[model samples]
Target: MNAPALKSKCLPTYLVIDTSSSMKSHESLLNDTVDHVFDVVGNSPRVAEFAHVSIITFNTDAHVVLELSDIETVENLPTITCQGTTNYGKMFQLVKQRIDADISGLTHDGRRAVLRPAVFILTDGEPMDKDWATQFNALTDASWRRRPHIISYGFGTANATVLGKIATKAAYLATDVDKEKEAIVSMLTSLLNTLVASASAQEFRIPDDVPGYTRVPIEFVD
Candidate 1:
């Protein structure tokens, strides 16, 4: 019998961020974190050469702050703001729509490609949105052809159990609340490095550094 074949990849990466009021306390740090992440991902030759980056910032409402496209100039990304509540439902639904659009646009006539859409969501509080389970399930099930890779992180008393549920795997936690701002910034940089590195190699692994990084109970299964 033939062994399973390796799949080809051209994964278009997507970042779904949480910019809720809970982040207001760490607004300055959050801004720096996002800025740094963009730099890390956009500046890397591997990511810049092959990956299309899309950024989605969510609060009480979800919005597509940026769409799927090659980021030739990372500086061109609009400055994101934080306000409103934590509505995971809005975020999941909006992202699902965008994923659909991307898959819909793909043409089989092109090279053999696998578009792995990845999402990285960071937050510091509980969700304020109702009926989030519906959208969350739809996204985590991997029914979409783009098959998303979602990394959700929580900090400062966020419900690890709940966030973990949304993310498929347990969510990572930035446990240093007293220094939560800086800690989150560090995680952002680290995660971006992982994303870009994966894009460049066309293959990747989670927790590339081999540190458990305080991820949630759901992730413990791994």
Candidate 2:
């Protein structure tokens, strides 16, 4: 008897990067890190088979540099450049809208299952927008499904309080590494590996802890 082919499930992953003026000095390093991370994920059978990756860049505004595409089909990933002030509010709003649209597309396009997406926010500075908190709160409201587990990575002048609030699962401070750029790259690589392994095993949630990454404490808001 011929066995039926199992339906392929899709796990959407978003990389939200800060391209504000503060990151200008390390822009090249950031590009290299992104390239390497994508290479590792794109080459992995587990990730390539199930992961749909997207890229979003935020500064004065937030925009999707790359829409959701399967790892195997994605090529020529874009490079980020430092620009205007960081507007976390704009970023959060765009992310919320994108998630809604992406999920709908996945459901309609024949994916057997579309797991809760994972969002990785990497930044080196604080938000210049006053309404960032409000936006973040709305984006992560309890009513949302699985809420796209957010993992924040902050360094350089980034505020811990902001990162913690934005992270739904855990926020990490990428310090302690010998070199700042190297540490950032290493942290990103680790994230990619963890994401691929978990999604391959059909686990979509981000872990609360990762080796060598310092956890940031979340702050309570009234």
Clashes of 1: 2
Q: What is the lDDT of residue 110 in candidate 2?
A: 75
- Model 2 spans > 4 angstroms off: 1-6, 205-212, 219-222
Residue-wise C-alpha lDDT for candidate 2, range 14-58, written one tens digit per residue? 889899988888889988888888788878877767788888999
lDDT for every model? 0.68, 0.80
Best by TM-score: 2
Expressed as tens digits, the lDDT of each residue in 1-222 for candidate 1 is 984454345566677777887677776776666666677666665676556677888897888877876566655667778899888888888888888776555433242575566677777778877688888767766555555777777777678777677665336776644566666766676666666667766775456331334766564222
Q: Best candidate, lDDT-wise?
A: 2
Clash pairs detected, candidate 1: 60-85, 170-219
Candidate 1 ranges beyond 4 A from true positions? 1-9, 73-75, 106-111, 208-212, 219-222
Using alpha carbons, what is the TM-score of model 1?
A: 0.82
